[model samples]
Target: MFGLKESEIATLITAVSVEGGGDLDRVSIENRFARATWSGLAEPGDRLAGRAIQQLGAARALSAVVEHWNTERFAAELSADGDPVAGDDMRQAIDRWMPRLKSDTALIALRQAARFGARLLIPDDELWPERLNDLDWHAPSALWVRGTDAALAGIVDGIALVGARAATGYGEHITMEASAGLVDRGYTIVSGAAYGIDGMAHRAALASHGLTVAFLAGGVDRFYPSGHDSLLTRIVENGAVISELPCGSPPTKWRFLQRNRLIAAASLATIVLEAGWRSGSLNTAGHAAALGRPLGAVPGPVTSAASAGCHRLIRDYDAVCVTNPDQMAELAPLVEREIDVSEIDSELRISSATPGSEVSAENVDTVGARSPETTRLIDALSARSARTADDIAARSGLAITAVRAHLGLLELDGRVTETGRGWKRVAVAKPETSRVFRSPSTDSE
Candidate 1:
């Protein structure tokens, strides 16, 4: 009906239906086409478009826009069905939507997407991430994906690692470590396909034989950061490249900001490996925090200006200071529960021993119970020399406050002792020895 022959319409419908693995009836096919049209007509994160599709079906919503129905008529029609979008907002939305409407735009977008081997994913698709629904009215109208469906679904267990495009060597190194670590821990990596930290995260994850998804600001067919063309191609082979924009659409500044929300929403948590004070990666962190997702920041040297954003998040935004993959994985509750409970229980028991008492090999078996932060803090301390909190913080790449807190816990656990110089790690029993401890529970034995 939108300037397409019957055969053309059937082809478009079949393309979407086949990718979705569904048998589309007449109504379902029209609805799929309407959503595809909406993807082209509206910008990403357009709440009015989301609301329209949610209230009226996609087909009815497309017809209302294409038929040039005025706001008053549209409102009245929708209001009869108890829709809440009937006032000045609806009028403004129509104004914004009308100028972009073209009879052939959607059909061309569909053809271009097919040519690029991309699939159109609507909300009904099984591979569609249910987490995106958390965006509410800002969720994408549809996703244009160029990769495996399994890789797309892998995003549910993914961690978003993002940072400044002009990343420093320190930033890239930390990104590599965190990305590979998370992958080893059974989490997928998610990031925008930009240069710097994002590229490194994807590369590291792929090198570790893990899936990584890149969310683009432009069409999936047109990967941004032309330098990463080869990187994006590899991701498409092993993972996925996805976006809300249809084929032929170029990336814009506004789209890039909107795209950050998807990166934040799709992952279990968001970690800023390295960022500057005004880096765009901070926008993704903001979205993650707003969505109530766990947020982590890797601390960098205080002298490095590139890490100012991470410090800001640690000091001001309540973002946890994560120095390694073990810490990063803790940001996701699912991963945290899997990695923490048993280990922490074991550590707590070991730490509860009498102060100055020797820990046994049995206690050493529970060494994994220590948090990564605690481990790093201990590593920064020396048994022969006491160091100040600031020195330890600098060595550990942790916030001073965090270093002090860990020191306090270690002091109570007898793992460290406060001296006139500062603090020193206590010489716990070596793991090679099988020194036994007498306990009331074991007295009968």
Candidate 2:
């Protein structure tokens, strides 16, 4: 259906729209189909694609690709409209997207979603999680949600609870108490649906008969950690299981990292119950901090390694030290911070094309104009400790060859160091002005 009539597209899209898209006007139909197409074509957090959609609008952006517009042509079009994307970036983006541009892929995703009784929520939907807009170019194009609309809507008040998969009893207890307490306080529990703290958060939320959301790295159709299938099913029944990818996508290391951005942005704040230094939960916490979301971490026994990341957050970042549910609840935003965030983003956008742009943690890696792979690889590295290529590969979910290539390039740039043991990230000094990040709301079920 690459060149299908608008009506034809709507027929497929409406099948997965909320209440069969009572609001599916001609423009809405085209945008919905285009975004669903973009969602499947671009990986989550594909900044260039996000830029394309932001500048060109989803429908026209899709048409640009369909019309076989090359980088030069796309850049001219974007430049003429007052947004100039560096040519090399545009070339790389189009190169990656072209191979995945099967005419029927969006159609398949829409059809599969329809069969699965899932709804595709675009930014225009009333039920859309507006807070995610704070992510700007990193925002998801569309979300595939399998559950009640209430569950999706509840993200406004969502508070992400993330930590290690191998949680200690102390961690699980804290999570259970915090999640259930938050539920009692009229909040929706949000987590990634992983083991340990995440699972406990969802389970406690459900046990309390509170709403919960599980944002998946892959498609809603397939549950990751197959062990969590039944938990996910319950989440779908009592809350929602959501994903940015289309029906057939599988969870990978890269997608999981990108997926953390959604969890951090969608929630008003995030709490790290427990995590080791290298735990994936630290990635989520980083996203939360970058978003200027009020981050809190629970302190575990000082001797426990699982608590090291939480301790790191509290010590190194502005993360609040929250112990119980009562203290955790205080971290929620008192006012919507979207306007403040938008203003900071506007400044960054205006300043980005210039040299030496001052970037806050919110968009530090992105504002520097790094490649996505470089950004991911950098995120996978620890500045405090060296790691072998195999460890980096496992952490980044990148192939060993790809990891080595990135490492080599990074080493040349003096961004990482190779110790005899492994590699360590080179810590770069930030400008004094970058200390501030423009920083969000409540959810109900």
> Which candidate ranks first by lDDT, i.e. highest?
2
Q: Estimate each model's TM-score.
A: 0.74, 0.78
Specify the highest-TM-score model's number: 2
After superposition, the stretches of candidate 2 with alpha carbons farther than 4 Å from their true spots are 5-8, 81-83, 333-445
**Model 1 accuracy (lDDT, Cα):** 0.76
Per-residue lDDT tens digits for candidate 2, residues 185-265, read 878999999878899999999999999999998889878767889999999998999999988776755676688889988
lDDT of 1 by residue, 43-114 (tens): 778777887887777889888988888888777766765656657867767765665676777788888888
Scored against the true structure, residue 62 in model 1 reaches a CA lDDT of: 89
